[model samples]
Structure formats: C-alpha cells, structure tokens
Target: MKKNFYHLVTATLLTVVLAGFSSCGEGKADQQAAASQTPSLPVISLPVKTLTGYQSYPARIEGVINAEVYAKISGYITDVAVDEGQKVRKGQVLFRLETQSLNQDAAAAKANVNAAQVEVDKLKPLVEKNIISEVQLETAKAKLKQAESAYNSIAANIGYGTIKSPVDGYVGAINLRAGSLVSPSSQTPLTTVSEIDKVYAYFAMNEKEYLNFIMAADGGVRDEKIENLPQVTLILANGEEYPQQGTIETVNSQVNENTGSVNFRAVFDNPQRLLTNGNSATLRVPKTYTDVVVVPIESTLERQGSTYVYQLDADNKATATEITVKDEINNLYIVSDGISKGDRIVAKGIQNLRGTTTIQPQETPFDSIAAPIKKSFR
Candidate 1:
C-alpha cells in the first residue's frame, strides 16, 4: 500500500511541471506578436498640378523724377511759401530769402546807371553843338552801356533770392523754415519735389537669375524675350497690393560687379498720387509651372539646415529624404528634386516616427491633411 502512494505522488508532480512550461511558452508568443506590430500614420501622395509660382524680391518705390529744391542765393529765409507734403507746380515759388543786402547793392547799381545815362545825354548834346569832339561823346556812350549791364546783373542776383520748384509734384521734407540761413553750397536741400504722378519700382536678382532669364525665355533674341515678358505685381509697404500693374521696363545688360546682381526697373501708374519717393515695398513676379511635382508644405521638415520629407517605400517603411524646393504657392511646395508624382509621403505626424520606421499608411486627401490646424481657445 505504501509503494502505491509514492507512484501516485510522483505522477502528480510531473503533471504540474509540464503545465508550467506550456504557460510560459504561450506568454512569450503573445509578447512577440505585440512587439512586431507598428503604429499606423497618415500619408499622402505627391500630385502633379499646374500651379503658378511667385518669386519675390526686396524692392524700393520711387517717383519717376525726384527733383531736389535748393537755395539759389545765400540769404536768411524770410518766407516758406509751401509746407511739407503740399502739392507744387513747376516754377512755383517755394521759399523767399531776406534780400535786404542784395537790394541795397542793386540800388547802388541803379544810381550809377542813372548817372552814366545823364553823362551820355550831356555828351551827345555837346557833340551836336560842336562843343566837344565825337571821340568824347563815344567814350561816354560806352560807359553808359557798361553801367546798364552791371545794374542788370545785380538785379538778377536779387531775383535769385526767391527759390522755385524745379518740377510739378508733391513736396517732401522741408528742412528750411523762416529765418533759417541758406546758401547755394548748403549740403541739405530746402525740400524735395518728387514727380509722383507715376512711380518706378526698382528691384534686383542674383547672377544665376539673370542667366535664367536669357535661357528660359521663349524668343529668338534677348530683346524679343524682354518684350514678351509678363507684367509684374507690386506689394505695397502696408501689405496691400498696388492698384495699378507694372511692366518690366528696362533690364541692365550686364551684372553689377559690386553687388553681383542684375538690376531691373518696373513702372506703375500712380494717378491718385499715393505712391511716394523712398517708399519700401516688394516685387512679385509670377511664373507658371506645368506638370511639376508638388507636395503639401506640412509634409516637409527641416533638419540641420537641410529640408527633408519622409518618403515611404513599397514595404511601407519611412525613409528621411532630402528635397529641393523650387518655389512655393498658396499651400503647396513646388519640388524640384528628391520627389515625384505618385510618391507616397508621410502627410503629418512625422514627429513621432524615426528613420526607417514601419508605418501602416492611412491614406488621406492632401487638402484635408494640409490645412492649417486652428488652435482652440479657452
């Protein structure tokens, strides 16, 4: 009976050992399945769309002609006829100088002229009465002519005290005021009269762009290409678009050695006289792109100065790829390299993934995924 009890206990211990092994094996299998699964991420496909890209550059707005109004004679300003920002006409008197000294000099010159005329009149009668020689009368007449010329020159100098506007336009910064001493050699101008009925927008591009203009044009000659170029738009300093459109009027033939850029001038109409000289602005040149690869701007990332996008392979593994951006539209980036049409890329949620991460792609529309997310307010 004791031998039978021992056999039964040994069989129970064996059964318990086998069950423990089975339980451990099943737990390991479940852990492996969970570890192999990768989280899914939203993705989008690159599309080929006809988009117009704009290349903008820093620009300056100037009047067609900016004329400096200067003092013509040296004297204290007695009257400032126009104020700053006032409209003026060509040849309109802008300032009056105190010309009391010039007036005194002119008065002295006029008296000399009268005395010389009296002497000439006296000599002519003497010659006619045979009381003096013809040579004497002729010498007196020459003196009279010289005196008249001197008087006229002095009178003209006195008239120069009144400064006039050189052009018909609006007045800019008036530095001189009543009782201010001015001169012909003064460094500062009395004011600037800018002819702003029309304005010129000046801008520049680098040497690479200058060559591109010659190469990308669709004409046989350079002149023909310039003529066929499209009109450009002006962005005002106030972040508003200028009412009138501008044409690319003149392009510098050679690049500027100092600046390493080529200058371009555009002209716009300012009938309302809104644009002023020395105003800052930007120039936007629209370029049309066709059959080009484009991706939403949100899909791109920048790493250490290089722009990148997470590209997916056939196996759904994400690879951090670099791309060259040609230009930008409203919400899309016109890519020049590193991506093409039908290429699948991570649309959003890239911060959570790493290089070569396996992702289950949840395909989403580009617009819906690319729209700027609005933050909710408390």
Candidate 2:
C-alpha cells in the first residue's frame, strides 16, 4: 500500500510541474505580442526660417480732435438740431436757446435809438446856429451813442444763444435735452463732438524703449530723414487688426518720473469711422535682433529646468537637443545656441516623447502652421 501511494504522489507532482511550465510559456507569448503591437511615436519635420523681431503692447484708440459743446449764454434750450452720433461740419448749429428776452430788449433799444436820433437831428441845427449851449448839443450826441450801444449789446447776446460746432466731428452723449436750462457756468455739457476722420492713438512706453529709440535715431541706425516714425499697426478691442495704418506724429519731450514711461501719439486715417475714441488697441513695434537663429516656438520643449528639442538621426530616432532661447518674436523663438541653419527640428508633439525614441517622420508644410504676419515690413 505504501508503494502504491508514493507512485500516485509522484505522478501528481509531474503533472503540476508541467501545468506551471505551460502557463509561464503562455504569459511570455502574451507579453511578446503586446510589445510588437505598441505604436511608434509620430514624427514631424520643421523648416528653418528667418523672422523679424517685434514687440507688442496694449494701446488705445483716440480721436485726434475731441471737443465738448457747451452753452455760451444762460437760457432755456428750445431746439437741438443733432442727436447723439450725428456727424456734423464746422460751424453747424447744434442747439438754439430761447431768445425772446433778447429780442424784446433789442426792440426796446431800437425805439430808444430812434428817439435819440430825432433829438440829435433837432439839436444839430441848434448847435450849428449857436442858438443852444454847446453842453446841450453834447448831451444829445451822448444819448444817441448810449442807445446804439445797448442795441448792439442785445444783438450780440442773441447771437450767443445759437450754439454751433467748433469742428467737423461726430456728436457724443447728449447731457441736456430740449427744454432744459443751460448756462455758461453750468457744469453739464450739452453734448460732445469728436473728429474721427483722422484719429490719434495714444500709448506710453518705458524709459528704456524711449532711450533706445533716441539712440537709434541719433546714431543713424534708423532713417535720419524720418522725422515722424512711419507704419504703426492698430489692433482693435476684439483682437482684430485694423486695416488702416498710422504714423507716429508726436513723442513727449519728458518721461514721467513716477511711471518711467514716455507718452507717444500716432495718427490714423479712419475713413470707415470704425475706430472710436477711448477704444483700446495693441501697437506692434518692429525691432531687430542680430546673429540669432529663430525657430517655431512649438519646436522647443521644457524638461526640468532646461529647454530641449528633438533632432532626427539617420536611424529615424529622435535625440533630445538642448537649446538656449534668447527671445520670442511673434510665434517664433530666437535661439542663441544649440540650433543652426538647415538643422531639422521637430515642431510639434514634444510632450510625450523622450531621447532615443524611434519615429516615422511626415513632412508638413511650414506655411500651414505658421503664425499670422503683417502684409509688409515697416
């Protein structure tokens, strides 16, 4: 009985060992299949190109001429000829005040003047014949002058009741409506008129920028004949580029001591009247960097504290290439080191990749993913 039990136990052990070996083989096969099925990293080819250096800052749209129309004399407003946003020309009548009192005063003055003229006519013969005292004739002449002066004063006051536009512009908010009392000393404005045909954009830059610009001008680095800087771009509030270009018309003589910035003003021709006063915009200023290689910003990758990019090799493997970024111009980054002209650098998909990774490269057109640029260089 003991011998039979030992044989059965031996047979069970062999079968268990065989099952374990088979299971191990199957696990290895599965692992091999998974390894073979793993997808490869995608490859992208980017071209090397030269780019201009530019600086962008927030700017605002301003009308070259902004005016506030106010009442010149004290009276009740009877007529308002223009509404808000109404375009007007110079000398156009904006509002008319009640002039009944002035008119009545002028009529009374005219009656007095007529009476004085008759007295003067009657006294002229007396004075010429020496029948009346010289003092009596002088009194008549003085009365005629006083009446004429009163009539002229009333006429001038009546003219002041009609308010006219000082410039050709578009009307702004109407502070006073018809039948409202207005006066020369009133704090309320009747309305505002802004000239939009040619508008001004005002902005401020730091002292460093101001000094650099001055140095460039003085050193002949920029065109010496250019008294006013040409070609300024206007970006609208909605981040849209304005079709019209502007010129730098004025620069402040002194920089602000507290802000350390200098004020600048640019003038733009606004034929469409699209830009309004106080609308914010961005000003794109052109600058140049020397001896630098610029590449698409996407080509760079950050790892730890260092920046890198993938460079392709003959075996279709990507090696991490460390780069030193100098500055960013638009969508491109200027590299001071670690990249050269004609070197193919990966433009996208650098996040999920590493050194010595194999890839299948596909060439993409540079212009398709390139950043939007200005139509012409300044």
Candidate 3:
C-alpha cells in the first residue's frame, strides 16, 4: 500500500510540472507574435505655417493675336521674303506675286490718262472762248475722268501684288513656296502670323461660380476688401508658371447651352513669346473668406466620400478630424470649419495611416515640400 501511494504521488507531481511548463511556453509565443506585428500608426511630418496665401488652377497660354496670311491677288508666288518662325514687322513685305499682268494694265492706263489730259487741255480753251459747245467740253472732261479712274484702279491692283504683314509678329510656316500658284479665294493659307507678346487665357465656369461672383459684387463686396481678387496666374505647358500676372478682361454675356458654363477670357502679358493659341495651360484665381481655418491638403484623407485629417491632441495622440473644405488653396485645403491655424496636423505619410494611431512626428524640410504647397496655395 505504501509503494502504490508513492507511485501515485510521483505521477501527480509530474503532471502538474508539465502543465506549468506548457502554459509558460504558450505565453512566450504570444509575446513574440505581438512584438512582430506592424504598428498601426504611421510616422509623419507636419506642415509649417507661413504668412502667405496661395491659389492654384488649371490654365492655358494663348497668343493675343493670331492671323492667317492669305494671298490677296490671284498669281504665282514670285518671291517669299520670310520663312517659318521668322519675326516680322508691321507693313513688312512677306511675299511677292507675279505682277506682270497688273504692271502692263497700269502702264496702259497711264498712257490713256496722258492722252485724255492732252485732249482736255485743248478743249478747255475752246470751251472758255465759246469756240465749241458746252457738250463737247463736257465730253472731253468725262473721258479724262474715266482715264484717271482706270489708272488709279490699275495702280491699286498692282500694289496688291506685294503681300505685306498686317501686324508685327512671328510668321509660321509658309504654306505656299516660291513658284507656287496662290489666290485670294484659296482655302489654304499662304502663311500664319501670330503676335505672342501677350496672350489670352480662356476658361469656362459653371452657373454656380457665375452667380456667386454676381452676388458678391451686388452685395457690395469691394475689390480692395477681397484678399485675392482681380489677380490671376497661369501655368505653361512645360509646367512653369508665367511670371506676369493677369486680370479678368471680360466675361461672356451668355452661358453655353451645351456645356452649361460661362466663358471667361483673361489677358496675360507674355513678353517671352511663350504662350501660343491652342496651347493648354492652367489659370489660378483666389477666392478668399474672412477668418477661415485652413489646413495642408496632404493632411486630408478621403474615405467613402467623407474627407478627414489626422489632428494631434494635447496628449500628442492622433485624432481624426472631419473637415468641410471650402476651397483648395495651392497645396492646402481651406477649411470652413473643424480646424484652426495653430493645430498640429499630419502633412505627410497620410496614405498608409488611420485614426487613433500613434505617430513619431518628424519635421520635414520646410524648403522642399513647402515649395509645392506654397505654389499651389498662392
């Protein structure tokens, strides 16, 4: 009985030891798994504040003056004085047409004018002395007038043979080369001329924008009171901004039925000849409000149609903030509500981030990322 009791005790002790060891191994494995998991919070840098305003919009550059040079007379091109991309002045000779027929007609008319003058001279004395009837003198005078008219007509036609530039501009490709036949009625242009010293930027706005402008103006919103009105900037094709600023030249009186938008035209001085007609560019205009809160656009996130940003709390923890973005200024969002100027908001690494996540905040180089944001907002 004693030996049986000893064996039972030994077995019981071994079972308790194995159970405790198994529990410890499981706890250690759980700890390892927890340590290997990725952190929910992503580290990011915040945007710094600067005392500047920014506005960005899609814009296009265009030539203020675009012309299609056409032949005024029907003849073979005798001479082409300008080539493609050549600069020309107003009244500069661009091309010459075969003027042999016009020249001969002018000479013939001059001869007739001379003959008629001699006849009028002889008849004038006769009429004055009453040597011939008034009808004869009148007939001589009528013939002289007819000859003069013919001479002037032929001289004007001859002048049309030399094609002169109508404006000071750069010439495009010469469609008709020397020895090519041309005419005033031809469908093809002889060349194109464009004045690129200034350009016209055109855009369209919807009824909402149009009505807002009208209401603001009618409500006694003065231009000076508006923070960033009356001034606009443009983006070129190469993504470089045009240095010169522009103003609202004119707004079309009517809205387009098909597009449901109002046409707007703004003039920009392009001294470098960078802007051309039919080239695409962006036109950015600023719409400002009083005492509005704004946040960096990079801080905002969209989920299921809702826009939000990660705002830091007093504890340095992230709190998701829902914002009503009134407008996007440069690279920032103009928040009508939900955030203030001094709030610490995450501006980078937002794509892989979520609400309530812990973050290691890092200060981004103000010069690098801020440049694009400043440009976008301004």
Candidate 4:
C-alpha cells in the first residue's frame, strides 16, 4: 500500500511541472504579438499650390520735397510766425528778424538819397543854362545815381528780415526761436518744409540681389524695368502695413562703395498725412510661385542645417530624402526639386521612427492640414 501511494504522488508532481511550462510559453507568445504590431501614422500626398514669399529690408520714409529753410541774413529772431507741424503756403511769413538796426540804416540811406536828388536837379539846370561846364554836371549826376543805388540796397536788406516759406507744405521743426541769433552760415536749418501729399520710401539691396532684380525683369531698358517691377508694401514701425501701395520709381546709378549696396526709391500717396519726414519702416517685396510643389513646415526636420522630409513608398516604408527649398511662405516650403507632385510623405510623428520603418498610414487631407497653418500665419 505504501508503494502505491509514492507512485500517485510522483504522477501528481509531474503534471504540475508540465502545467508551469505551458503557462510560461503562452505569456511570451502574447508579448511577441504586441511587439510586432505596426504603428499608425498620418501621411500626406504632395500638393501643388501657389505660394508668395516676401523679402524685407530696412527702409527710410521722406516726403517728396524735403526742403530745408535757412536764414539768408544775420539777425536776431524777433517773431516766430508759424508753429511746428503747421500747414503753410508758399511766400507765407515764417519768421521775422529784428529789423530796428536795418530800419536805422535805411533812414540814413534815404537822407543821402534826398541830398543826391537835390544835387542832380541843381546840376541839370546848370547844364541847360550853360553856367557850368557839361562835364561837371555829368559828374554830379553820376554821384547822385551812386547814392540812390546804396539806398535801394539797404531797403532790400530790410525786406530780407521777414523770412518767408519757400514752398507750400507742412512745417517740420522750429530750430531757432525768438531772440535766437541766426545767420546764412549757420549749420542747422531754421525749419524743414515737407510736401507730404506724396512720399518716397528708400531701401537698399546688395549687389547680387540688385543684379538679379534687373535681370529677372521683363524689360530691356532701366525705365522699363522699373515699370515692370511688382508693387511693394511698406511695414510701418508699429508693424502695420500701409494702406497705400508703393511703386518703384528710381534706382541709384552707382552702387555704394562703402556699403556695397544699391539704393531704390519707391513712391506712395499720402492723402491723410499719415506719413512724415524721417519715419522708419520696412519694405516688403514679394515673389510668387505658381502651382509649385510645397510641403508643410511641421513635417520638415533640420539635420545639420539642411532640410529633410521622410518620403513613403508603396509598401509604407519611410526613407529620409533631402529637398531643395527655394522659399518659404505661409508655414510651407516651396519645393524646387528632390520631391514632386503625388509623392507620399509622413506628415507627423517622426521623432521615434528612423530609416526603413514600416508604418500603417492614416491618410489625411493635405488642404485641411495646410489651411489651419496658413490662417495662423496670416
């Protein structure tokens, strides 16, 4: 009976060991099934869209006429007739100098002129009566003419004391005030008169950029090239775009040696007097690519200063490919080469994945993804 009990115990132990091995084998099989599952990633097909890119440069704003007002004579400023930013007409009185000294000089000159007139009248009678020699009468008349000329010169100087506006425009700054001494040789101008009905925006481009601008234009002559240039936009100091569009008017004949840049002038109409002299702004010139292949900026990866995108094949295998980017606009890169239309690419979730990773692609609409990004940028 004891022998029979030992056989039964051994059989029970053997069955328990076999069950443990079966459980371990099933657990590993489940883990392997989970690891083999493919990750689902968003993918997109390359689309052709029109994109416009802008190149910005620092710019200076000035009125069409930046006329500097200077004093023509030496005197103390007695009266400042106009204030800063006041609208003025041509020939309007701007300032008046102390004319007391000039008035005294004119009085003395007038007395001399009266004395000369009396001498000329007496000489004329003597010459007609033949009482004095004709040569003596002629000499007296010449002296009278000289005296009259001196008196007229003094009177003209008095007129110069009242300074007038040289042009019809708005006043800029009042440098010299009442009781301040001014002269023709003064380095600073009394004021600036700016014609702001139209304004000019000056900007510069490097030598290579200028050459490309001229050569890409559809004209043979310089004037025609300027005419063919697209209208540019002005970004004000506050980062707001100006209401008016500006046209390229003139280009400097020679490039600046010190800066190695060519200057360009663009004109804009200022109806509400919003622009003024010496205002700072930015000039934005646009270039458009029509029906070009573009990729979203979010899908791009920068590796060593070069842009890259993961391209997908028919078997859903990703391969990192380098693309040539011509420009960027609205959160998209204008693809010039390397990838073309109808090409499939991994849109997002590429951080963990590397070369030759097979994926289960979840197709997403390209426009739906791009539209939101474009709106945010705008």
Clashing pairs in 2: 59-281
| Candidate 4 global Cα RMSD | 5.1
What local distance difference test score does each model get?
A: 0.85, 0.79, 0.74, 0.89
Candidate order by lDDT, decreasing, is 4, 1, 2, 3
RMSD of each: 6.0, 8.7, 6.9, 5.1
State candidate 3's TM-score.
0.68
Q: List clashing residue pairs in candidate 4.
A: none
TM-score, per-candidate, Cα-based: 0.77, 0.69, 0.68, 0.87
- The backbone clash count of each candidate, in order, is 0, 1, 14, 0
How does candidate 3 score on lDDT?
0.74
lDDT tens digits, residue span 257-279, model 4? 99999999999999999999999
- Best lDDT goes to which candidate? 4
| Model 3 CA deviation exceeding 4 Å by range | 1-60, 212-230, 276-278, 287-304, 308-322, 329-333, 338-374
Worst 10 residues of 1 by lDDT: 369-378
The digit string of per-residue lDDT tens for model 1 on 1-378 reads 999999999999999999999989999999777656776789898878776666788889889989988877899999999988899899999999988988898899899999999998888878999999999988988998888999998888788988899889999999979989999999999999999888999999999987886578678888888887778888887888888889888889998999999999999999988889999888888778888888787788988887889999999999999999887777677799998889999998887777788888999987686554221111
